[model samples]
Every structure is written in C-alpha cells, then in structure tokens.
Target: MSARSLRQVTLLTVVLLLGASLGLALSLRVWPVSCPEAEPYQLGRTGRCVWAAWAADAYVVDGDLEQARERVSALGAQAADTVCSLAVGDCATCRGGQAEAGADLAAALGLACPDGVEGAP
Candidate 1:
C-alpha cells in the first residue's frame, strides 16, 4: 500500500479505538453500583445502603448507638436523617420508657411489635 494510504488507515484505527475506549469508560462510570449478595439491606436511590431497621430500633430503645452508627456511617448524616424522618414520624412521645419505646420503634420500622406492647402503633 502507498505510505499515504497506510498512514490514513493507521490514524483511522487509532481514532476509532480512542472513541470506543472513551465510550466504555463513560458507561462504566454512569452505571449504578450494587450491593454484594451477602448484604441483606436495600440500597437507597443514591446507591447507598439504608440502615437496618433492627439497628435503629436498638439504638432508640437500648441506647445501643454503636451498631446503629456503624451501619448509618455509610449513609452520612443527611441521608440518615432523611431515612429516619421517613421511617419514624412524630416518634418522640414513645421515649417515655424503654419497653414502650422499643415496641414503638419496631412498629415504625414496619416490624410486628409484640402483642400488648404499650405505645406501639
């Protein structure tokens, strides 16, 4: 082949490869991240794991904030607050006692609060 023709072919190949590589990179970055199979929690819209309902209940009732904090740390403060607001609306009244609070928190988390547990709704 003539040198001019060969150069044109080489340039075309390089440009095509570069374009394909850029497209692939953009696609990978734009794709949503997923949680591994071992995780039992659902990921929020932003691809972050929402807190375990049990953990939040434990924190509210038993003052076991460590486990809850560990789980929520991935969500950041603002996201955690948002999740809390969605799950537990006007729950402050339940704080009068640990036993009642625990049941209320469980109910707020969509779990079955034990029968005859006061303040559970």
Candidate 2:
C-alpha cells in the first residue's frame, strides 16, 4: 500500500484498539450473592445488581411471581433494618423511630412509588 494509506490504516487501528481497551476497562462488573434486591436496579447502578437473588431463585424454582412476592415480602423488615443500620449506624433509638414512622407513613399512603406509576403525564 502507499505510505499515506498505510499511515491512515495504522492510525485507524490504534484508535479502534484504544477505544476497545477503554470500553473493556469500564465495562460493568458484578458479583452475585445472598442478598435482597435493591428496589429497581437498572443501568448506571453500581455493579447493576438486579432482583433479589433469593426471590429470583424462588421464582425460578416455583415458576410463579406469587412465590417470589411471598418470599421477598418476608424480608421487608430485614431490608428496612439494614437500611437503617447503614444510615444511622450505632445511633440512638429516636432516629430509628423516626425512620420507622416515616416508612409507616409512606406505606399508609397506599400509593405506588413513582417508578411503579405508568403512562405519560
């Protein structure tokens, strides 16, 4: 090939290789384990952890969402506790009570979360 064409080909190959290397370095990395789902996991979420592993396993095993819900619902309290512990680790009972009350109030509203709402505005 001509010198000019060879130079262009080499530059193009370098650019493509660099782009691929960066993409591979930034690619999503995840480690699955025993844990509850983090609400709705989607793109841009760190590690992209999706549905609760246990709930997914139950659903896969039973082939029904009813079993999934029944299983995941029972972990609600534990999930809430973990959230609180993460938020106010070693804090007094007042903060914990406030968190509980706020959660209860939100639940009592009986409204689906914004994410659950469908259709256009």
Q: Kindly list the per-residue Cα lDDT of model 2 for residues 1-121, writing each as its tens digit.
A: 9999999999999999999988776663443232233332221223332244224334635656455445545666543333222222222322224333323322332223223222201
Model 1 regions more than 4 Å off: 40-121
Task: Identify the leading candidate in terms of lDDT.
Answer: 1
Q: What TM-score would each prediction reach against the true structure?
A: 0.33, 0.27
Clashes of each: 0, 0
Residue 55 lDDT (model 1): 52
Give lDDT per model, in order: 0.50, 0.39
Looking at model 2, which ten-residue stretch has the lowest summed lDDT? 112-121
The root-mean-square deviation over C-alpha atoms between each candidate and the true structure, in angstroms, is 10.8, 14.4
Query: What tens digits encode model 1's per-residue C-alpha lDDT throughout 1-121?
Result: 9999999999999999999999998876676455455432333434443335435655655666565555555545654543343343323222234334444554443443334544444
Candidate 1 Cα deviation (angstroms), residue 8: 1.6
RMSD of 1: 10.8
Give residue 6's lDDT in candidate 2 (0 to 100): 98
